[model samples]
Target chain A: MEFSSKLLENAVNEMSQLPGIGKRTALRLVLHMLRQPATQTNALSQALMQMRTGIKFCKSCHNISDVDVCEICANPNRDESVICVVEDIRDVMAIENTSSFKGLYHVLGGKISPIDGIGPHDLNIVSLVEKVKLGGVKEIIFALSSTMEGDTTNFYIFKQIQDFDVATSTIARGISVGDELEYTDEITLGRSILNRVPFESSLKL
Target chain B: MEFSSKLLENAVNEMSQLPGIGKRTALRLVLHMLRQPATQTNALSQALMQMRTGIKFCKSCHNISDVDVCEICANPNRDESVICVVEDIRDVMAIENTSSFKGLYHVLGGKISPIDGIGPHDLNIVSLVEKVKLGGVKEIIFALSSTMEGDTTNFYIFKQIQDFDVATSTIARGISVGDELEYTDEITLGRSILNRVPFESSLKL
Candidate 1:
């Protein structure tokens, strides 16, 4: 399709690269953005640049943070003895929004997908095991998706940390299927987190 | 909802100001934008800025253009004697995408919505009438939406040029209902354009 201008084309191209956005939706979004004031557009542009520059993975939990440790990991009131493990920063936000979870978090960065060449070593699994091995942590909750990769990662983490005294668990699975975690609302995700089951005994086979 | 950063908050606020985007969708879009490459983000930003600074409405047709007149209006092959009247530049684009219509276009900028304080004066209707009055225009096709506002605008335009010998018509209403012209695909829009009927003379009251 012939675009109105070069800038509009560029904006649409960038927007279309997003996960759910197609060319038509991207065009709609770009047009919508254009109708806004210049300050708004400038703010969006500045935010994108600043997010890349200022936000870094927290050294402790690996969640996106401005400081060395993320807000959840740094908070003294949160339970340090229990760590909820997840695949990305978005999961951290999801759990945080519930206001029910009192524990800290450890982001694995990604799951072990063999097809995508992401293995246990490629993730932050070693650090998770080390954190457990240090001996103060009482529980480790796995909040990975219900995909094969998530299952593999969960199993690998279970095996690696079996020697430790830490109580290992995985978030409940009944609410999710396939590659659908991205579609799950916060309430469903929160419910899954709340009903986590012991993983070592469940996956012993 | 607590945002991770000020920049993120600003971007979300800006996106939420758009016609259809809610705060949640805006946040989702901002987060999605954050995952993109710097070059893509930069391109989007550049496009937004450029769209604001570079694009101006065509003097004759009111279609968005970099020069005095849009490409369609400036083109020699387009039928200057037949002016297709549309609600906006996007309607012009929808018609142009068909590649069947050889006529030029006149964008009204918006439909006549009395509830929204928009009227014939708010649109480019006066300029459109002036263009038609200048002589050689044989047909003035009203390619507006089927909404009440669209009907109102169409009637206003019909009244403006009733004295002239130029034939006035409206695109066929067979495919859509109420403010749905924006959603109609190019093929259907093209068909509608081709099957337009002359304004009923009895409804002049």
Candidate 2:
């Protein structure tokens, strides 16, 4: 059926475009926005706008930030000796929330997927290697997903950094498979971090 | 745990403030946005900003619109003589979605809730009465909820228009109590419209 207003229809269409939001859910959200006070609606609008205009990927870690370097990278107190490699900024945020990780992060932007045309060169792998070669990093934690692509990316990174004196480790995949690291709850994530094994010892590659 | 960045935290906080969104859902939405292409993220942000800056309530019907009069109110094909009185614009959209009602709408803004300090004057009741007094109105279909506040508002409107010759009617309350008109599926809504009873005759108030 045709919607009452084109604007409402447009808003719903936009909302439905997002992952997990169906047409019905989008409709409900749009209607809820209509019921909200102008101030609240304005705040949501401002936040959304600011998220795009104000934030950019950090040059050092590839994590989203309003400045050149992310808060983690800019913080001098954080350990520069350990670099946690993640597939996305969400994974970095998830790890940071635990307050247990005092190290810096390296967001690969995405996992290496041959079918998806995402190769090692497509990621920030070169920058990671360059950072490692600069010589302060002692450990490289592969906090990527346990998927095929994640494994491929991890193997490629391992090959590229074999010459470095840093210890290479992958976040434990004992109980996690077919799930993004970002989706794993904090408790599970913390456990996984503590239970992580040496990549060379576990993968034998 | 504290968020990774202030902007991300702000976005999450604002999203959580939305009606049904919780902290986890807010985080999911933010992460989803982060994963999307720059253009898609920009579209969402632009839509949110435009929803406030471009949209305004139609003066004639109080429905959300980009122009002064809503598309429904401005449409010449709609039956201006038949006015559907509803609690909100969402109700108006619900009715319009059916394509069965070609009538114009008068949004009461909200129902009478004295406990919540919402009196008759707090609503757009005066404007509704003025519209009825202008003449040429043949019917007024009250499509309010079955709640106490909805019933009270219906009664007040019924009393005010008792002197007028307009055929006063109401959408059927066959659905259960506390059921919002917006939440009722389109098929049920259409059926309710088909089986609507005369307000004055059925209630006998």
Candidate 3:
């Protein structure tokens, strides 16, 4: 789209560089910012710059943090003996929102996607293996998405840790809560059946 | 959602304040930025800040510009006698893209929306009327949206310029090009029939 001003065009160009935002959406956003007070736009830009420059990663878990170690790793109440391995910090936020898991997380940054040129070395696999070999961790749960990349990453990590004295498992896959059985996909339905639990164990309080 | 870090939360909060962006989408965007190089984030932030702080408005038409007067208004080749009044810079860009109208533009900044606490006084209507009074203008075209607020703003401007020598007109409202007649609503269809052009005019190359 032709912009009336180069400044407007420049702002739109930068805004559209973001994932999922297009030129039209960027223009709309920039126009909206223009309509608001200059301080608001300044605040937004300041926050983004500050966050990008000042952000840190947890040394142990490789998750985005403001300190050397993330809050999850620093928390004494969380189970340090257990680590839930996932793809990125988003998954960490998702699992934390559920409030169901009390264990620490190990963010792999991304799964092993050979098609995308992302190998085991590209992720935090080496540090994870080192953490497992340190010998205190009792269990390491693979909480990655149920895809080919996820499975491959899980297998790779498992092979590297098989010699160590640690238990490794993957999160169970099934129909989500509040979903109807008829609407569920065949693959998930079949897996849910094959991974069925005892009736007594299913009755969790 | 509970954020793992204060900086991440701050960035997400600021990003979500943009129009049409929600908390989840904001988090997704922030995470996407975190995955990218620090330079990309810095560039985006700097662009937004620079644009907001350095942008200028055309003194004559109130359209966004990098100069005291916009290029369109300063052009001697454009039809100075005819001014096309619009809501904002976006409308100016849209009309400019069409390459149909050769006249200059007068941006009202926004329409008269009482619900949004925006009135004629809040817009650049006074300057527009003053320009009309000072000009040797022959025609003033209203290219505002067909909403109630747009109509109200148009009528208010019309009242101010009705006594002037300039001929006042509005951009025609009708079924859009490439739109099926059957799928169109009755109001637009009826308006299209009522405002039909002559057979010869429709045959224009």
Candidate 4:
């Protein structure tokens, strides 16, 4: 816990401020940086600072971007009428990796967790409702996780846009393709059974 | 793994370069930072940059310091006649926490390891030998870990200063206090048995 140098202590303290990193881990990381060339530290700090200060969010989707508008939002080929609602940019990237969804995304930045003091007003809910109200959008798919916060946020957003003429749906909850049914949680298994689709309809995909 | 923004990717790439951090963890950390205020990122980067660029090493002992001479070396109360050789500043801090030894420390920065391409020339062995040759030091204690690399580094330094008039010794290798003999590793247990000290000597501490 005792540091020989104040500078070393400061660096370790700052590094430990990050989530999941402890003081010992911070010390190891800072020492690693010290052993490396100055340019390495320079690049790390410079890149972090640049990301924090220069990063932008798409005005339409609220996903992280380098420009005023992200490529997905700016792409004319993508369908803007069906917006997939999700937690953050990571979800956008995850959905994009599948290449199955042709619709655009609406990044909520985070779920509405009152335990963490985050509310509907703190997220990108207003902007999303604004996008829906502007009227060309038809369906809004709730693509958030299955957690309580995800469901709460989904319901909250659904309520906000319920008066407007828009179809609402949620991403299907079922056993993953390669997962064993025996290992599936009871709630998920029950939901999968209740929401079962026609076999012929499944083959169409 | 796919990044929507180049700046975000750069930050994640740079963050992942730190020891023990992988790309997924790096992305998690970078996203956590993005969720936080800009000031948090600024403070972390500023602290790291300051530590890297402004850090100094003690001229005498090679321990990290904020000044030309470190506090340990500059302390008049510390016995400069005896030097405790260690691997890094962390070792110095550990020994200091024990509050048992009053001798000055000589940090070797790292131990000799062929696998890692570290050699005696890469350490601070020359300066330590120089201190002994100047003829005021009485003893040199090797306080490195009991690993092969640690022993190699110790033996390498011992050969360099064997002709000098100073006495030499190593920190005792034994079962730690409060450790059960049955749970101790065979090698350490065997060494502890062979190097057993007198009953009276054990009572002194």
Candidate 5:
């Protein structure tokens, strides 16, 4: 669509370049901003610029943080000996929201997807291995997805630390808590049956 | 959801305040931005801020423009005697896209919505009346939506210009061009039948 203003056209072009936003959606968003107070737009732009410019990642875990060391890694209450390995910061946030895990995290940044030209080297796997090799980690839990790329990365990292004294495990794969048994996919159902826990263990939760 | 970084949280909060975006979609967009080069984020923020800060409205038509008078109002080719009144710049853009109207536009900024506390004073109706009062305009076409608010605003503006000699008209409302008759709403279908044009006029098109 033709825009009368060059500035509006430029802003819409930039907005539509984002992942899921299309030209129509970008226009709607731009028009919404125009209707609101200028201060609202100012706040949004300021927050985005400040976040992009001032953001940092945790030196140890590689999760996004406002400081050199993220809150999870720096907290003394979290068990540093048990590290949960995951793909990115969003995973870290999801796990943290559960409040079930009391351990630290190792963010791999991304899986080993060869189709996208992203290999193990493109991730933060080397730093994770170095952290594990330092030898205080009692157990490294693989919390990546069940995709083939996730499995490959997990196996490669497990090999790198196999000779170390640390024990290795993976997060359990099963049907989601609220999912129906008949609707569950075959692979997940099979895995759930194979990895079934004792009845007494299930009662504990 | 909890975020490790305050800046990230702030940015997401601001982004999600937009019309259709929710927390999950906001997180996905923010994560996509984080994965891209810092320059992309910088460009987006810069363009948004610049557009909001430096944008101007046309003095004559009130259409958004980079100059005192918009390109349409300033163009000698456009018919200054016939003014198309619209609710906003988007409507003007829509009408322009048709490539049929060569008349100047008068943007009302918004419709009259009592539920939203918007009235005639909140719009650019006075300037529109003044344009007609200046005595060169021969006709005023109301190109607003057929909503109740749109109709009220049109009537209010019509009353203001009724004392003048200029003719007044509204855009024709009926079944859409390619709509199926069975699925068309009764009000529109009835109107289409009642307002049917002469067969010779139809052949002229």
Candidate 6:
């Protein structure tokens, strides 16, 4: 892990500090930067610095944005009364890709992971609950993942806004659309069977 | 692959331009940067810029270095008479890790790969020939990978240096030390047998 140049070593060390990047990968990336045109590296560095300092969050949903409100929240075409609660912008993009929902989003930033010292307050739960309390929202759909932390966050939010006269529901859990029944995990298969929709409703899907 | 913020999108796009990084991975890295303290991203950006601008190569062997002469070439203890020619700095570091060779290195930067439009003149081959022609070098070992480009580069150098008094050799091609013989590839197993060294010579290890 020794390097001939201190500059190269320093660059590699800093790069390896990033998540999922190991020392070897850092070295490879640094060397690639060295091989490419200086402008390429300059552009990359400037872009990262500018993004870190200039990135904005939507005031409404706390999703990453270039302005006070994200595009999803700003769009009049999107159904504002039906808010989809998600963990981050990635989930927002995922649901948007499916084109299944025309609702606005309330990004929580991250789930309530107590083990990681992240509680409900660490996320955007306060803003979300306040929005529901304002009384325009009709349905709040929990679109967070089905992990323990995701479930806890969903339950905590539901408890806070339950008496506000807003309908609360969760995304359906089932085997993936194209997955085989034999390959479905036990818990997912069991839940799908237990919550099986009426045959006529399934036919609509 | 859409982004919520223009700054975030720019950073992710630049990041994804790096080898082996996809859009999803780029987004993940950018998001991680956003979650971290601003100073972390600043440090990474500064380090990369400093390394790119200030990095130097050894004037003697063309290896990446902090000064005109590299450590291995400057060291008084290393053998000045023998030289190991390698493809790049990574190979130099790999051989150094073995701690078996005591000679200095000549890094060619890359092999002669015509498919990549790289030629002998494009590499440090001319300087290597000049070094051999100067008559102080006693032996030159071709330590490049055993690929077609590597062999082509090796043969091209050998052709230029054949008239010189220096002896020439290449790294041995054989089964790895701890590898199972039964699983060894046929070409390597065949070559290992065909070029077998004496039993006593191996037993000396």
TM-score of 4: 0.95
Top DockQ prediction, candidate number: 6
lDDT value, candidate 4, whole model: 0.94
Q: Provide the lowest-lDDT 10-residue window in model 4 chain A.
A: A196-205
Q: Candidate 4, after superposition: displacement of residue B180 in Å?
A: 3.2
Measured against the true two-chain complex, the DockQ scores of the candidates, in the order shown, are 0.41, 0.35, 0.84, 0.82, 0.79, 0.90
- The 10-residue segment of model 3 chain A with minimum total lDDT is A196-205
Predicted candidate 1 versus true structure: per-residue lDDT over B1-205, tens digit per residue: 6765556666677667766678877777766665656666677666766776666777888777777877877789888999899877568778888776899888887888878888778888888888878999999999988778888999999999999989998776555645488788787788778776566942542
What does TM-score give for chain A of every model?
0.79, 0.79, 0.96, 0.97, 0.96, 0.97
Native contacts present in each candidate (fraction)? 0.47, 0.45, 0.86, 0.86, 0.85, 0.95
Candidate 6 lDDT for residue B183: 100
Interface RMSD of each: 2.4, 2.6, 0.9, 0.8, 0.9, 0.7
Q: What is the descending DockQ order?
A: 6, 3, 4, 5, 1, 2
Please, what are the lDDT tens digits per residue for candidate 5 over residues A20-108?
Answer: 89998998899889888999999999998898888999999999999999999999999989999999988998888888899999998
Best by lDDT: 4
For candidate 5, the lDDT comes to: 0.92
Summing lDDT over every window of 10 consecutive residues in candidate 5 chain A, give the lowest-scoring window.
A196-205
Candidate 5, residues B1-205: lDDT per residue as tens digits?
8899999999999999999999889888988888899899999998998889888999999999988899999999999999999998889989999988999999999999999999899999999999998999999999999999999999999999999999999888888877899999899889889999888986753
Summed backbone clashes in each candidate are: 0, 0, 0, 0, 0, 0
For each candidate, give its TM-score against the true structure.
Answer: 0.81, 0.73, 0.97, 0.95, 0.95, 0.97
Q: Chain B TM-score for each model?
A: 0.81, 0.78, 0.98, 0.97, 0.97, 0.97
The C-alpha stretches of model 2 lying farther than 4 A from their native spots are A1-16, A22-46, A74-76, A114-117, A173-205, B1-4, B27-46, B74-77, B114-117, B175-205
lDDT of 2 by residue, B1-205 (tens): 3665678878889888866788878878877887677677677766755665566788988777777888888899989999999987668767776767889999888899999889999888888888889998999999898778998999999999989888899876455566998888786788778887788875653
Q: Candidate 6's chain A scores what TM-score?
A: 0.97
